[model samples]
Target: MTNFLPMTKDDMSKRGWDQLDFLFVSGDAYVDHPSFGPAIICRLLEKSGYKVGIIAQPDWRSTNDFKRLGKPKLGILVSAGNLDSMLNKYTAAKKYRSTDNYSPGGQAGLRPERATIVYCNRIREIWKHTPLIIGGIEGSLRRFAHYDYWSDSVRRSILVDSRADLLIYGMGEKQIKEVAAQLSAGISIENIRDIAGTCYRTETLEHLWDYIEIPSYQDVVNSKKDFANAFKFQYLEQDPIRGKTLAQGHGEQFVVQNQPAMPLTTPEMDEIYDLPYQRTYHPSYTAAGGIPAIQEVKFSIVSHRGCYGSCSFCALYAHQGRIIQARSTESILREAQEIVKMPDFKGYIHDVGGPTANFRQPACEHQMDRGTCRGKQCLFPNACKSLDTSHTEYLQLLREIRKIPGVKKVFVRSGLRYDYLMAANDMEFLRELCEHHVSGQLKVAPEHISPKVTKLMGKAGKETYLKFKKAYEKVNKDLGKEQYLVPYFMSSHPGSGLKEAIEMAEFLRDTGYNPEQVQDFIPTPGSLSTCMYYTGINPLTEEKVYVAKTPHDKRLQRALLQYRNPKNYELVREALVKAGRQDLIGYEAKCLIRPPRNKQNIAVSQPENWNKKRRLAPSRTQHSKTKQTRKI
Candidate 1:
């Protein structure tokens, strides 16, 4: 076992302490989720003989937390996945800033300004010369210039905003390992530009800064002209080669460098999944008194990595890659055995799924050869002809898992790819999956009703969703079970303004299903959808689209998904009014319209108005007195 000193201020002040072999800062909560990308990276660094300490959910109250970790002998590894400061703050801000979600008790509160960026900047301030390497979903997705929904404007690359030494996009296991090894051997961060999966700014590039010249916060505050220019600059993506050339042209500006994308190796993924994780809820946050032992565990395992769905509003494909990589059945079974050995091992194994539970391998055989896939998408309106529909091996693996002792139920709670499901020639495997794995409901993503919006999102059309829904129902009826499909939907995506959103609402109403939850479109960095959100054009096709630019409009589109709520009634009414969509406001227009409220009834109460008048009168008197005193 590798021996390491405990992390503390005292230990950090020691002679050799100036140089930490490794330091891991996670944007996620300390508790390990199956999708804890940062935790896995930290463990990998530990395994490689690095002294690693984690700063989880960093407190930006001061720079002390960053300083306490001490200067790393190598550098800092920052991951903002599973828990991103920006996403966390944005969610909070949305709740607090909205009049509808607000509570009298101040239930929703203001978030700290620029939470993620500020936290990173503070760390840089503390360790002035230390290399700060930013990765994970937040960094990877926002590596380039893109639209920021929270700020309602285009923003600079995350590297510039975070002031990090380097930014790594996509999965960072291999890239980080290489960076650590190189830095430990006395290589400078500047010399490591050739490494794939990294982005950095350099002074040498010419014209590189021309398009990327964003106004400083003060500059924007001081002049509207500077702010507008910065907004335009924010939407641009610099040509990588030209950016490098421009850096060389400009002697003063540092050359911006980017490494090619690096993918994780099979062995590395296997090693990460095999970590000794206590996969229960954090003891402090859980309602249950104690941490549940491994014996009480029923089933747990991740099936694959990455997604190919390419939903425009989704950030998963950006960070995890669109390629699907699965571990062999033998390796997965080994994990199952470990869970079965736990003292409280239950007969049920709760989860065995990944991004899309049904997608076990790459859609095309070219992926095996590391060749470019000519296929536009794995999940088009229908399954790709090249897709391997065979599930014999997968079925056999499930059978083997069931034979294991202490295993009762093996559940697949992850959302399934219905498009892929409907294409299968044989439904036997799917029937078996339902019979053994499903716990009454199978979740799937049928993001929108309109084909136009669906095409923009690179997802299957409404017909596909309906076809799968019908097939699923038939299967359930045949089995004499009441299993249901819980379909996931997204509102206010880049191409989905009020019109498309209303169409989705109408579709939901017609189906007689009011979804319990709906995901609002968050234009995270590095996604194809994010590009559309930023530029108002599809990156691939370069087609212009109607983007919901205003915050209120976006909110209205999101509210349409929750048609059951009366508060949403005002939202729908306002949206229709603003869009001049009077045709949809009537009682029976074949549209999903919210009922109008009496305007007079909603006026401020007499007592509340009187209280406001009383408060303002005193403030006015105080102001008059202060002015008279100053004059005297």
Candidate 2:
């Protein structure tokens, strides 16, 4: 009972099982913790009285590694790990990353690029008749014809490319369990298309009713405008209550996505989190340094799931949906107590929330009966009147966790929606957060300071962040604490041009804070921002937006965010001059960077064989006034 599900045939024989009910293939090293998606799915299947085997990070070059557990009697469940495999391998700049935190020993390149497609193709080679189900972030996001940032082209749905029988979008706990039961009950995978939160390929749409038909696959590839339109249609129908079935043509067959599954109730969420998770990597990985991703969440507790923040660049809406489902208070406190007993528990809880930390309930009561509003967000532009912004329950939960014996400090490492916090009528929660929860510095993602860019990103106005900043400072001052705020900003987001980046640089200069790292926008699939980035038009508004496409322009925009750094000074200067704001290059108090050191500095800063004219009159020389001080 203390052992993990069989990973090898010898272990399988010891379990006295002839054939598994399911074989779960994953792109990440197996860490039997609730935070790992494959772990949660496999445990759910196991608890449902199924013999589930795991094949983690298999060699994709051939089918040998995939056949280790043999084929399951019911089906094959495939996932591209917890993260999108492309994102795992490449940075926003499309450069190969050196380490993969989800792998054993934090090794890179253990999982192949596009792991889901590779795994499914291999399974097809050995077991052609078994049901193939693809899920997780990579498959879910690419369940539709999506723009592949790594390839710079629109690709067909993963269902088509992987040739899997089904793709479970969003969190697949409910969907996967239902599929398993139906399959066990002697239903064919192709016949199990009526379930919610699932996609399947079919040759005919005669049986479907009241579904929205998006543009065909070839149409999206032929026109970026059509792709934008298709995305908008998909975006409006993500809700479980009011969403309709979506059908898109792929050659002779069609990919149909049913309406999203209803969000898990509080008790359902509690039950899932309460399952017997080993809460760590298996003992087999002890020699390989264990999975590095577990270290971040080992002491943390996920109090909830789903986010209503709905930032344009985030895929939470597509993957987790907008409905918030949280574990009960009693359930969370129980987990905290369990953490306190851990041998590695050093009197601190790393994090206490998920997605958005302060969100303990839905945006409003109606979202339970009706789904999240279409074409509108709960907290973007302005907080909706129906938005139930309260902190009483969450504040009480935090207080209770802090009082747990042996738990010295309960920190909230997850990002908190500052605008939501500001919506609360009372400042007591904010006061408590500053005094106890903040660990010297609290990180908040303001993303950008310009109103234009923030609006395009579906974030609150710049004024909201400024207001929260003042309130945070006031609370810290009253508590006699020197806590600081670390605001995260992005560069080269759609609708942000040189002028906007320059304005952001000025904002940073005035605030007197220098950020060491800046995020350049990467157009990940399934986000509204990616739509805008690909089509040059906001999918929601149908208005053209400026996108920094060239490497030179993107580098300039990123440099503006960290203009204080010595290396970025030249890039910042070049950007300022290009934007015709040369005033920002001088030695003035508000200037972002000083004039280049000397003529030699200019030569070194300019690009190779550069012949552009010297922009700001040569670096002004500093003159000693000792001899000229006679004038009163």
Candidate 3:
């Protein structure tokens, strides 16, 4: 059948099944699109001859709403939606957000806080002995007893907190299939702990063989050095091929995480995307303005998975691993053909890329067998010697996508790895990208121009960004195009102080671009940057770093990015003065802002008695005359 899987009891009856084999509960509203992780996992289960039903965003106030789908015959699958629930609900300041893109109608607060723990606990309350499996960004990233930025302390593993029988970390396709097969064969959840990409709590160490034991939960919480050492080891062992089983003790019990699952091959990636997907939100949500997250990716194509960039603030390494697994060109073209047939299809295909648009293959040949280097990065600290810098295949694929009928333009909306592109030195791809892909503006993240800050953020030096900017301008000039590079910068990241923020502001002043929006570093879980923010030490190097923790400093740093805005005039001047740059506050061309509108200067420029007498109330005629006089 081409319809969505059973979502309610009536739909289950129509399927002629007494009970579903698996019940998937998600924090997001039901959307059967491929980009949503719940939809992908549920559909993959159905394709394997298992009956799966979805209960999305169920009322978590009690177990009554969870019983709507009834108990499953085999197990319950729970995901805290696509993005991490904490990240979706709170800003860096730990303030509640006003809009949730994953909810119906983009509503906020549709799901509870710490959604995975809430959903899993609710299932346990009713089902008693049923297998509760937790997988998603929230669960995967917090699988270990790492830091919790929201809680502001080191919490135990989610496997301990959620009371889940099994925790599937990372991309869970391979792990999900394995769990389904074992559960179908009547295996106990406790006995199924040996599978890769899974975590479970155990009382004894007998089940774990040849594993590395991370620091005990109590020790990590008490000692920053111990936590940094533990994280460094965990980061190194993330490679699927060379990774070892990792175990961490939580008082009397232990949370054991197995080696990461292997990366999918090209054919496997193609098969995963070729599966039947409704490719849109369930029609039941039409009245609630439909699911807001689907609009961005409904017409887009995901050509690959995983990223090699490994930025410090990003969690892709811990979740998707470092290797790149891509779908075939034929599969991409097939998806494009399907998009052309949609009734609402416009001539534009929004994006034809993945995590990083330009990264289409592994960094080197050794990565597949030996795994990513333990202590080294692929693109940072200069590209590795064995890195593959070819864009020939990706260039050809984009060209083919453009040739498809009904496709007027194909844009690469994902952030391009500028350092990677610079490594390629391929003018043809750059030429095609400048002429065809860019829509008057291309957004690239250089983060900050300060060498001290960029190094701490795991980004290339300012020299690399400058080289790319020059090259981009040359290409546009040659093509007779007016496209511009809108660079992304962050404020208040570790290693960024008032001095570094002012340095970035000077770079912005020179470049003639004012950022409309700025990102303040929010210390989310499973990131190196968050570790530094919490412990004041870089985990990789064990060096004490500067972190802007006060709200006053953070606001001052953010205001420097948009120093031209008159609303931020006082804040910008304050930052400049505080950073020992008081010389930059005068009427010089290089000054960030005029010296706070001096009253003496205003008196000289204004009419004789402009502020001599302040009027609290005025007649309509007087108000009109005052407004006209001020304008003159």
Residue 549 C-alpha lDDT in model 2: 88
Model 3 stretches astray by more than 4 angstroms:
599-632
Cα displacement (angstroms), candidate 1, residue 15, comes to: 17
Q: What are the per-model C-alpha RMSD values against the true structure?
A: 12.3, 7.8, 7.1
Compared with the true structure, model 3 gives a TM-score of 0.94
Q: What is the C-alpha RMSD, rounded to one decimal, of candidate 1? A: 12.3
Model 3 misses residue 265 by how many Å?
1.0
Q: Global lDDT for candidate 1?
A: 0.62
Q: Tens-digit lDDT track for model 3 on 371-480?
A: 99888998898998899999999999999999998999998888799999998888889999999998777778898989999998889988999999999999999999
Q: TM-score of every model? A: 0.77, 0.94, 0.94
- Two-way lDDT contest, 1 vs 3, winner: 3
Q: Predictions ranked by lDDT, top down?
A: 2, 3, 1
Model 2 spans with C-alpha error above 4 angstroms: 597-632
| Ten-residue region with minimum lDDT total, candidate 3 | 623-632
- Residue 173 lDDT (model 1): 75
Query: Each candidate: how many clashes?
Result: 28, 0, 0
Clashes in model 3: which pairs?
none
| Residue ranges of candidate 1 with Cα displaced over 4 Å | 1-19, 32-34, 96-116, 205-262, 278-299, 343-345, 368-370, 555-632
